[model samples]
Target: PAGDGKVTTPTGVTASKVTSGAVVLNWQPSTLTTGDGPIAYKVWSNGQLVATSMGTSVAVSSLLPGQNYTFSVQGYSGTHASAQSAPVSTTTAAAPAQKPVRSAYFDQWGIYENAYYPKNVDTSGAAGKLDVIHYAFANIDPTKLTCFEAVKASDSANESNPNAGDGAGDAYADYQSDYNSGTSVDGSADTWEQPLKGNFNQLRQLKAKYPNLRFTISIGGWTYSKYFSDAAATDASRKTFVSSCIDMFLKGNLPTGVAGDASGGAASAAGIFDGVDIDWEYPGSAGGHTGNHYSPADKQNYTLLLKEFRTQLDALGAAQGKRYILSAALPSGQDKIAQLETDKIGAYLDYADVMSYDMHGSWDAKGPTNHQDPLHDSPADPTTPIAPGTRKYNVDTTLAAYTTGLPEYGIPGGFPANKIVLGIPFYWRGWTGVPAGSNYGLYQSATGPTAAKPLSQEAGLAAWKELNPPAAQTHWDPVTESSWFYDGTNFWTGDTPQAVQARGAYAKSKGLGGLFAFSLENDDASGTMLNSMDGSLR
Candidate 1:
């Protein structure tokens, strides 16, 4: 031991884990210690001493955002100061202010089925106003083992739709259709040999015109969710599925089978999407066909799958210098909610879009008529004994479960309130054979399938655009924050501009991020529902 010799300086001083207001500094232990045995290290930043630590690392905090700073370390021995090691420099990330996400879901099949193509959208007054538009949907091709596929005929469920012929989605509509007229967002002709054409190109054009708009491809809806269980069964499978997804959507890897291979040079779809939105119908429950996979382990595996997606997305975002968003269309039913680790799942998501609608519909043959998207439960008799399982599951209860019940399932205090988006429906559910009453058949017993309306022409369903229910019969329920109408034999339940306004107000008051609807095309051609939503949110 060189007792009188000077102590060696700490080597390899470096800064890691740099954040908005903090930087962690680490250095190799000193080579030569004071005669008193081991030595402490002095961490300095910008020539000013910050901290002295017995260990190799020290965390310095309270730094200003977007400020550049350099750090170095020195080995200390008694009263002697060793020379400072090499300095490491870094700039703190600018802390971004949280903005509310006013988002909506767009259906791709709407182009042909409803004749509501991107061109039909009121870009100046409607689509352009939304912050996020989730395109529905992309499915896992069970045959191809790829998550990307052309929107197929079966994917088109518009049997009564006059605009839809054969019900097969047009790939040409996706990227290479010559609309020549109403399709252009700016009344400009399509650019030949463009990196993308058709609706995808139209969307790109729309985004170009409205730079604030962001788009996400929602994968695995009710019709196409059969493969999610298999895709996320394990880490390797999840990687394969996610890789195929990014390649197809984010990377602009066009399917030759449908759109014909066309890459618009280096700028393909490479950055078209700001993120991926998973619309896996029911992860651990049997909401899908009996052939679909269901298991108790799905609750745990679903969380794991989300973790993998977040890991992969974050890695890609880090490389691309953008933060990719992750979101899910969650089940509104408490039974379906049971399969999710609500508290843990939110950690991986940008937001949770709760499908608060479809709580009751014509699908239930002998069901009690109720508000399909009530903000709160129907007032039940407090004294009357009611089974906890039979409790009315409303929007408030769903929000409470995620924000409150998660603790019982292990996550204390559930998910963040601001990360939840209430989902509403833009269509009405109809039921027939209900006993005539003062409430206009609402919350009453009913048989199935009412006669088709003159507009929607569908027996049991009617889009808001086609729903011209007599204004005199329409009634609003303040308690549930919903609306209903019954004309003698037919009972109708759905959201109106007033109901949507009320829901938006409730969401804002509760600190929720925003509200979303199943399909934008369902709204009136004049943009009635969207205008109401925008007005309420503002």
Candidate 2:
């Protein structure tokens, strides 16, 4: 078909399998002619004008499968059309289907209390809906066996002298004595020789009641973090500690000498833990005295520990014919950015829960009775220019610290979608000396600071409820998205329905695993805050 006008096709269309019903078409650009001003091209399929193009190539979609179609291109200038290019034939193939979405949840020490058990532990009725349960082992001390005895003694002593200056000290001493005694608190039997007993017992109970529930054992909190460095310092110690932990966690047995009794240890541990959770307050740095004080070797060794743990767990699962999960609790402050080896650790973990609370409050200079975790900007800093007193502990900053700082340190998935679990606080912090109507103020006590009114000075969920009832006064902080009330002399702060919903919404927007409140006991009796959280998440 010789014609005066020139014909051209889009450049770089190589023949390759894309999908069953679609085929890509490409060709080279046409040589510019002096008289042909801005040539236009027309694409044809089986002699039908499928597309008219001023430039090169287009993806042809929605074609009949197994049907052969002839494609050709023709150039045009104004009203005149050129001869068609050589016809190219292609057959349509079938397209591949998309993958289905999977769901997951974070259990932040949820299984610690057996809400589904005999005492009707949880008044909120959230146990049935929970998919994962986090079982905590925070008070375990490797140096002692009678820890429970000490705890019981401490409780008894505190009750004896309510006004004693060292009442708290007496309680701590009793706790240590119990740990050393290796005897149960009730004196009925021997204390558990392994670390996984109490938590595992609760987990076993929960799983028996809810067959579909999963359990993860979280280790290392603010108080027990001091031992991590010492345990991970040398290869021998690391191996010993890691081996003992896994043996106890996976098989319910203590590793060698560490266990007082070895015969039934493996079987007991295997019956409880479905996964291991690492809650190292901070690695490669010191936190509490219990922390091991990690060094440069810790950066690499931590990764090694996770890898070995994963490998061992996988092997155990294959042996037991069941799958096990691994996860960690990451630190929230910006200062922890440089300490962790993110990529290696992230590779081994199924997910990580960031403890996003304790961000601000009396810890800071000015007192503001607000939500410890806010979704809005920091209202206190005018130069930074954020929503005044908005949710200061919002998802934005938390996500940024993890995704940006972590990956920069060779840690992958810092911004991993659906792999992060946002933490919600069941309590609130309040301050005193706050100016009235100034959007921020202090939370004072009723007896003018000197009175032993209600509870201790420290703000806790239980204390707040007793001191300030909803009927007495309405507590509200628009900027911080929190609430508080004053009983004439004392100012108090506490969690409410509004704050809980805000936390759930933030988790939803970020595609996170879910939301986890610190302790279920902190919620109101009718499950007001818990119900609000569940509804918001759903």
The prediction achieving the highest TM-score against the true structure is: 1
Superposed model 2: Cα runs more than 4 Å off:
1-123, 138-199, 254-266, 286-297, 363-370, 381-394, 405-413, 440-494
> Which residue ranges in model 1 land beyond 4 Å of their true spot?
1-97, 155-170, 191-195, 257-267, 380-390, 406-413, 452-458
Per-candidate local distance difference test: 0.69, 0.48
Count: clashes, candidate 2: 55
Candidate 2 residue-wise lDDT, 1-538, digit = tens: 3546443333343433434544455566554444544554555565445434333443343344566666776665544456677777777654344211111222222222322221122224655555455554433334421011112211211323322211111111111111211222111221333222232343343443444445665665554454565566666666666666665555544332222222122233343556777776677765323323557676677777677668777776554434577877776654453466654576788777777766655544344344455555544533222233222244465576566543333333344646777666655554555445443233321222222333333333233233435654645555556555554433445556766676677778767767665555444446565566677677
Q: What lDDT tens digits, residue by residue, belong to model 1 across residues 1-538?
A: 1233466877787776776655667678776553544455565565444444434665554355687888777775544557888788988778757655678887876776577767655542776568778887776767444565553465224533322322233455566565555567656565444445566666655554454466788887776676677778877888888888877776556565354534233223444566789988788777754445667778887888888878887776554334567888988877678778887998999897889998777776555677788888767312121224545567876787778774333334377889998887888998988877557787677788777765455677898888757789899888888898888878888988889889889988999988877778788777888777777788
TM-score of candidate 2 on Cα atoms, chains taken together:
0.59
Instruction: Flag clash pairs in model 1.
Output: 175-197, 175-198, 195-264
Cα deviation at 114, candidate 1, in Å, is 1.7
